[model samples]
Target: MTEHRHTNSSTGGTSPQLSQHKHEPSHRYSTGKECNASGSVTTPPRPSGIHQILCIPTGKIYIGSAVDLRARWGTHRWSLRRGTHHNFHLQHAWDKHGETNFEFSVLELVGTSDLLRTEQAWIDRTGCAARESGFNISNVAGSPGGIHAQEWKGFINPGGNEATIINLQKFCREHGLDFPSMHRLAMGKSKLKSYKGWTHRNSVRQREYIKTYDGFITPGGRPAGSITNLAAFCREHELDKTHMVAVAHGRICSHRGWTYATGKRKLAPRTYTGFINPGGQRMLITNLQAFCREHGLDIVHIHEIKSGQRKSHKGWTWREG
Candidate 1:
């Protein structure tokens, strides 16, 4: 996989072996297809440029542009035979289809500088990168997206009744989320409901009782027992989860028997600019979303006023702290 942008090596067994003679440059030897007058196979300089390996039976294809097509093919075959191909999709297909079912052929010949661009054009024209359509492991032309690289699928934050939909990778980096774990969760590969009280925006597995939720409580609202997952607790007690969150958030005074005993992050305080209310009242607001909800204000208008894009929103005006 050359997704990181490097010359691609071949997968054929006829890889270039170290030259036995000191004067001759390293030459790639085919499997003895050509022979000297002695009637033996011959070695040939590797061909270069855009080439493709096709699974004849399945019609799957992998495209690349590189020098030393033979050497690149050798590397491909070496990795595939060892079950270590960086492009897992191609490897998987190869495992299912017999090795003899594949063939390598050259496409358009291009200079080294144009290899990536030309290859990308071919990939786009062929639609080889479409999922399940071809063997390509990356949409990027020269990028094979080695096994370690992951495709990002955005996620949602489904806390309370509100939800936040955003790029999962960027969100994880900004919010200090565990990328691997959250990735699994977002991809629907993990059974975990929530991580540290944060929820996926559109996870089908999301439930009223979450793993990161605070725990069970006694009906008296006094000290209660704790649990690792609310779902597990609900299952064990045959309890309804509909009102559990309400009780947890104090929206409902109490539910069957549960209270929120949750851990909280201690963070440095934020200095919010004091804004002059239309009624001539100065209010120090920290959470804009919450304030807008409380006063039935449009957040966008408030942002415009604060940024000086507009003079004011309705009656709200921006003022410095």
Candidate 2:
């Protein structure tokens, strides 16, 4: 077997360093190995098989199968520790019990070609999919998992009601809309467009938290006019809604001789740390005002990211200092 180890210094000595092992080549199978959190070696059988993560206190097991059991276990541990695992139930249990209370084990070694079939048989025999039993979400082994895939569409629209259904391809074809774009929106992978009422039967309208703006004011603090919706105001004035909101919140004091007045008080500004590329130069600014003054960067764009309206500002990233 050939072995390779990876040391992660950023973990502060808490996380276990990972070691990967590859077995000598076999005509019918291959094996991978790793070390678990307990500093114990994991059994990686030739090719595929059933695996389990057992919670000692609860006696709850998460049954799974993988082509490479050791690699899968490592992936699970990494995701669970990072709080980004897809299985919320397993993640919750991990959080409650910590690594010490959990055990990773291989149940049976199966041929690579029989992986899915054997896995399905094991799942059926164990009743892993039953609620209050195991952590397996679906009884069907080797099925495509996650919320964004087409397999989940049936789960999302279980009723299959034709009345409420919106055929994405047909609708997009008729309307001359981009099929891929509309498909993504229908699949809940992208934001819904306001221009069309195009929505799938399972589509859930996201509740938007709209902020009320009173009106725009002049430089002398005189009332310009009342505008209820920021988007409407932007359209009427040909101003960017993002920029206007930044101005309204006092991120930028004024835009084009117009000041904003809001009935709701703005949030307290936060300090941010900025880093420049190429040389990794760092700067600390107390607020958007200080950042604008120091860097002479676009005030509106900086405000967008600082206020969480935009993710990135001119290819630069900022975090709370």
Candidate 3:
């Protein structure tokens, strides 16, 4: 007895057509052309998921989740090649290493609903931002999935009603203040009292928390002098006061060859040294390095002459210190 079997009309044979399984949940393929037995073309699955740009030489990867991987990769490549990419470090690396040295890879398949969470998880698992090796500038992801919103309280205006609070970033944007500076103020890390009339609720406590730095050292590791007010010192030295404060607070280590330290040193009064010119005019200098810096002369060369290692420099003879 012969048995009759049903044939798929699309295939024109007693065989199942591949397109018949297109809607199947288990069917998955990348975006490309799929030829059917009927001479018709079926579109492959569009990849929408996590992607990465890996620097083959450095092994540093920039992970990103996109709805359309091809389109995103094109945009990224365009921006990187044009040197207009938002990620400064990534752009710099791309510029340093040519495009051929980098490899674009699809890391994983993800759905729209799971995009942010999956991306954040991948970033965390890779420790991309946690370490300085990667180009990621921010430790937190773009999506709110991993944010501890409950732990972060908005800054309240102390001058206004108790309930009157504002977003720190918004306030900074509106007033031309820096968000990180204001955030540090709110977190009790900055000694700033206020920013354009917006004061952090913790400003008072922060003011008390920060230890006062009253002394400064020159770039050459010599004691400059005691300075009660950094702003005044900066004004006198024509230096950036805010940068000096940051250095003093240890927020930054050094700036423009100057460093900040606490406690005053009781050193002997700086005796003025004289430089004898060819015409016999004596130039009195309280700080030799400072004078050399002001006159744009090399201090080491001057020191060598001062120590009797050399005869003279720039037609000037170093006298007694």
Best by TM-score: 2
Candidate 2 is scored at a TM of 0.43
The lDDT leader among the candidates is 1
Clashes of 3: 0
Encode model 3's per-residue lDDT on 98-161: one tens digit a residue: 7766655555666667666766776776666643556665556563222222244435442322
Q: Which RMSD does model 3 reach against the true structure?
A: 15.4
Worst 10 residues of 1 by lDDT: 13-22
Descending-TM-score candidate ranking: 2, 1, 3
Please list the C-alpha lDDT of all candidates, in the order they appear.
Answer: 0.59, 0.56, 0.57
Give a tens-digit lDDT track for model 1, residues 1-321: 211112225433122222122222122223225333455555323655676666667667787667776578677878788776656677777788857666555555556666677677777777778766677867787653533244444443433334443444445556655555675666666677665444554455765653555354566756555455554455556666667766665566556555555522225555457567889777788878778888899988888888889787768887876
lDDT of 3: 0.57
Q: Give the C-alpha miss distance for residue 288 in model 2, angstroms.
A: 20
Structural similarity to truth (TM-score) of each candidate: 0.38, 0.43, 0.33
lDDT of 2 by residue, 53-72 (tens): 66667766676767776678
Worst 10 residues of 2 by lDDT: 21-30
Model 2 clash pairs are none
* Candidate 2 Cα outliers beyond 4 Å, as residue runs: 1-46, 145-246, 249-251, 254-321
